[model samples]
Target: MKETFEQLGKKGLIDILVVIDDSGSMTEEQKNLSTKMNSLLTSLKDTNWQIGIVTTTVQASDKCILTLVKSTDTDAEAKFAKAVQAGLSGSGNEEGIRQAVNGLKCSQSPWVRADSSVAVLIVSDEDNCSSRGADCPNSPGKTISYLTNYIEQTLAREIGKTAGIYGIFSPTVNSCKTAGNIGYQYEELMTYAAQKSGTTVSKIFGNICDADYSNTLNAISSNIALLLKNQFELSSAPDSGSLKLSVEGSVIPAANYKFSGKTITFNAGKEPANGKVLTAEYNVGAVPLFTKVTLKNTPAADTISVKVGSTVLAASAYTVSGNEITFKTQPASLAKIAVDYRVAAALKNAFQLEKTPIAGSLKVLVDGKAASGMTYDAAANQVVLNPAPLDGLAIELNYNYRTGPQLSYQVAIVQGAKNVKLYDGAKELSYT
Candidate 1:
């Protein structure tokens, strides 16, 4: 069978009935009701769904009147739109659910078919029924029982197999019940009826905020989706695997990943292994540079360009032997060594930097004399100037290397001076 709905074809339908409480008790938050109703109707219009509306009112006769509005014609959407605009207006009675359920039970429209999936949504705040007066010739308890039994035995039995009933109670009703107010009687009564009918109930107790609307609507849609999926026995959707890429020892999570028939692309962010490595775990495997590194997009060829700053140190061809690439290069300044690589079919490249080893010691000169008590380390990359008891003291750092000429290297003096005061024999240079 194709699907439950498809197998049954036109015989299957999804009917949603909205029962709104128009009694005086709902006057304070009529705006919220209208907003919620409009949002729900808008979401249902784009789908193959049918909806109906019913309003509850109290009469001078002290009885609950149920008014049903059929929403299945060419003008159904427009009519719902207009009804939501006109708003719900009523007074005298407080039993919205009683009228709603009665009207639903009596509705004879084609959209309310026996096989159609039916969902009745009730919105209310008060709990008393207008149908419970001595002149009405019915006790409140007995009348409520009759209504609950009617729903569970008749409507529920015929449509409950594919039908769902939901209730949204305003916060005012909850507060009243908790405060031991007269409204508590109605709250308890409705709770019983709902429990007996196997209906889902929720409470809305804050301002009509966007978050509240989105969350409530999402919950309703989730329930409907689950119901549809279960009835159709659909297959699970496909899963997308994770993309992997890295630079030297540091890894960059895959970016802008897309899959098309076994072909995947990492389009966003920098590609792994495009930059030089400033620090990394040394490798001793077939590739004696770095090891255990992984990448999602394999390079098209075994060759890649290794660069440091703007200078390309090596352009060699290599092969992925056990997921490692080996290259040869002449050792130069190890301070700023950058590693770069070109991957297969990749638009951009990846790189990393490696730290250089420090060499040489710093010699201190205070007032043209060897300051024997002063000491410094090259790894700290800085020198401290300490003034002695002598006045007019001159401090300097002297170091010699056999690889280069004895040209003066700029030394920064970070004392209580307004500028970086420089001194070369008798020449003094300072920058503010």
Candidate 2:
């Protein structure tokens, strides 16, 4: 799972492009936007912003405004209201997304700022005719993907800039009398903007039929303001080399920010403002111990013991194969477990059988003579000669038994405190 963290910051410079559908049927909506200009202006009065207008028609004179009204202008609200009163005599074939893109391209001079965030408000009651077909036969055939790519690859590519494209159109087919096809392409564009900005589509869209535009406009402006954060805190410490940062939808160059520990601080004059989607992707540096463990040596039969913390575990609690021990159930985080075992090998005075021998199926000899006092230790699965043989004595032991080496392990569980316990066969020891 990815560890994520988010934060909202103060306002920043933004260029607002209001794309209005000036078709014949949009008279009432045009009046609505003009009358509700105060709601939009009041929300952005305190911001370092500018407003521009454009019509969804190919007519050269009806395309876009060359100049932008800055927030600093005393008559900014008046200028914006007048601009939104675009007349209802333009073409019926409304290509809002396409015209919005055109407006940005043709009016980059005084209308679009180099480093400011961009917000596109498409006020329409019709679906976008971005692609070629009956929807808009005379269209440029630019798809929704093309328009969004322009925003990401061209507009947002500027060092810390972002773009939020919102839709003020029909939400569902037949949801409103004048709406056409529910503005499917337009809604898709808004959804894309919301995703790149780390917001929900609901936050970036408004139903064109809404009685009042106050709430929706305010919410959109507020969310756009949050796209201005210059700093963010990560949920966990991340590997420095694994960090990858992106703002809006464009990848930010590594040199654009200073990532240290869990905090990321953008370089001077390089903060984002298009959307609230500033993300830092990285791998966590630390992890917890989970299940299996490896041993230093292979254990001999019947000599295995396991423990977690200070609690001894039964042989049924774990299984050992070669030098790896796998616990039946994973120990809790930070729980200490200890395992001890005797090394398996053929040694001097003792013979540990691979398996249990058949009852009375044994013989013993020392120096070519029948030897006595020999017994089997079931616990160790070993054959022992009582009082061990004299030095240099040729001893022989024969037995009918099964196959593998006799091995055993001891484990202990110790919880609480900051100590680890280990067993060395004869004694239990603790170390901090």
Q: For this target, which candidate reaches the highest lDDT against the unseen true structure?
A: 2
Residue 238 error for model 2, in Å? 37
Clashes per prediction?
A: 21, 28
lDDT per residue as tens, model 1, 256-364? 3333332223333332222333121211213223322344445445344445456664444223544354444433333344444445443321111122223444455
Candidate 1 residue runs with Cα over 4 Å from true position: 1-12, 25-28, 37-47, 58-78, 85-89, 107-111, 130-147, 156-161, 171-214, 224-432
Q: In model 2, which range of ten residues has the least summed lDDT?
A: 1-10
Per-residue CA lDDT of candidate 2, range 213-321, in tens? 8878888877666554355556777754678877555888988887666666677667665445677777774455567888899887767788999989888988889
Each model's Cα RMSD: 26.3, 23.4
Question: Worst ten-residue run, lDDT, model 1?
Answer: 1-10
Q: What's the lDDT for candidate 1?
A: 0.43
Cα TM-score per model: 0.37, 0.49
